[model samples]
Target: MSDYSIRLYVDSDYEVTRNLFRNGIIEHHNKAFHHALQRPHIWLPALVVLTLPALNLVSVTTSILVVLTAVAAIWFYCRYMYTSYVDYALSDDMLDISKYYLQRDGFCFWVAETRGGEVVGTIAALPSSDPGGEKHLELKRLSVATKHRGKGIAKVLCRTLIDFARRRGCEAVVLSTSLAQINATKMYEKLGFRQTHSFYPPGLLGQFLDFKIIAYRYDIPAL
Candidate 1:
């Protein structure tokens, strides 16, 4: 892998990470049209996990009625924040991470094609309910650009992130998706991710579950 090197963004990788954050997020919203604009992101996984399920399951219909209201509530009460927590684990020195980043499209799309070169695949991380008692990662998005699909690129990316997270002390990495991207779910399964949970987007569980963590633990040396 001498020719291929994975760049870690932290405070040092701030600028680029920020760019990755901004461009990627905006692109995501434009296309998917989902997320808490104020803070649709899950900054506190455990709190969300606990409070949400504990929230009365409600009449199944009541749950339906609660959807837009919850969306409106979150839109006003939350704000989106980007992170390269893995990057922070990569270095001991304080990093200026806002610069030297990539966020052109969505991160899944961006990293899949950085430097205007061929990008085979992509993975997006988000928050998940912490039933396992640790902050988790959800695959917010995963895509293997059409030209590069069917190759092992997506696996490579996921394996790389798994290794990165292991070294960084992350208990797990997670993500959630719907019919819109069934292939992504399949890829995650190939990589050993079992669905701890699933739901219709904009559903109650959607708010409760943030990151979709895979079941298997991957350990590989980081480059």
Candidate 2:
């Protein structure tokens, strides 16, 4: 038997849930910075900067400082972008889970709690906003506490959402995850979700960084 129980969101879960969302999203900044640095466009410039000292154009210390400054700038930019996303999400449906999800038909948020009654994870399902996919559900806000992961809490939470969708007669369950969420993508695939498409997130920063969001769908088989 599982040690965790999944239940609908309650007013008391606000603070912890928000923190989970913020930290879970922000935690990817480091990975994103690393991924950004791996891009030729980004690293090539740093490489060129590093060669300056060898070319006798700049002192070794000066070259190192310039490269470090560029890396710091990229790190800060990634942090800012993620922070901005979290703020926007908090101001959106996440601002009031009860009002946005609990009260709406076919939209619900759930929290996973341990036997000791500690909230360890969160997941939400909402009607797909895409045209012609009204029967589909979009899973969102799925996050597990760092220390609590690898205990199958995330899988349980996903299964709970999937079961809920199936009972609601939904045609499919879909979710969008970013490249920085490599583990999440792998988990989704393990749960039988197939990649439908991918696109860069909206905004200039996303385009410049070449950050992409992959969409996955799990189609329910006919009963």
Candidate 3:
């Protein structure tokens, strides 16, 4: 809806980004992140880059080198974020989303929304109902402070996820959402993550249904 800037996650941003990620997955939605959050190798380099904090005492020059190295590694990561965007932006497939939010000086992020264009925007559009709702892509997790909802950051993040997923080789995208996040539901529909008449419990649904939240499948096909 509005304008926003995107960047990679630097080593200095490890904890902030990680927490944002964890929260997005664990807090708002408890669904598996694109099959599994850790399954994607996209986040490992950033984790490896962050291990340098313990070696900070090795030397000032070494520390600076590590920081710079981490920044470059992070820049390379920025490329993935962009690719993921491309994958979902132009496809009829699922999406992978990873991102950060601005904190006092850094960022905190943890919400990924995926949609497939093949599906309709609401349950009425679906051909029929199911025992557990229609199936869809298990996008990634996402979270934002209640104080920051109406600002439309989530909308930007949803679009970012679609673009990112498209870049990652997806034709469209899908997700399992819930009513606990009514505002987010509206955002998803607004962005084309239509409901498809699916029913998602209002609790986190892990790979094996690990949490207590309901979820609905939202899909976004190629544009």
The CA lDDT of each predicted structure is 0.43, 0.91, 0.40
lDDT of 3 by residue, 36-145 (tens): 23333434544555565676635555656775675555444333333443344323211111221222221122232123211111010111123442332234434543
lDDT of 2 by residue, 1-223 (tens): 2888999999999999999999999999888898888889888988888998888999999999999998898899888878998999999989998999999899999999999999989999999998789899999999999999998888888999899999999999999988899999999999999999999866787876767789999998879
TM-score of 2: 0.95
Question: If scored against the real structure, what TM-score would every candidate get?
Answer: 0.42, 0.95, 0.39
Model 3 off-target regions past 4 Å? 1-4, 21-138, 197-223
Candidate 1 Cα outliers beyond 4 Å, as residue runs: 1-110, 113-116, 126-133, 203-223
Worst 10 residues of 2 by lDDT: 201-210
Against the true structure, whose TM-score is highest?
A: 2
For every candidate structure, what is the RMSD over all alpha carbons to the true structure, in angstroms? Answer: 12.9, 1.4, 17.9
Native-structure RMSD, model 2: 1.4
lDDT of 2: 0.91
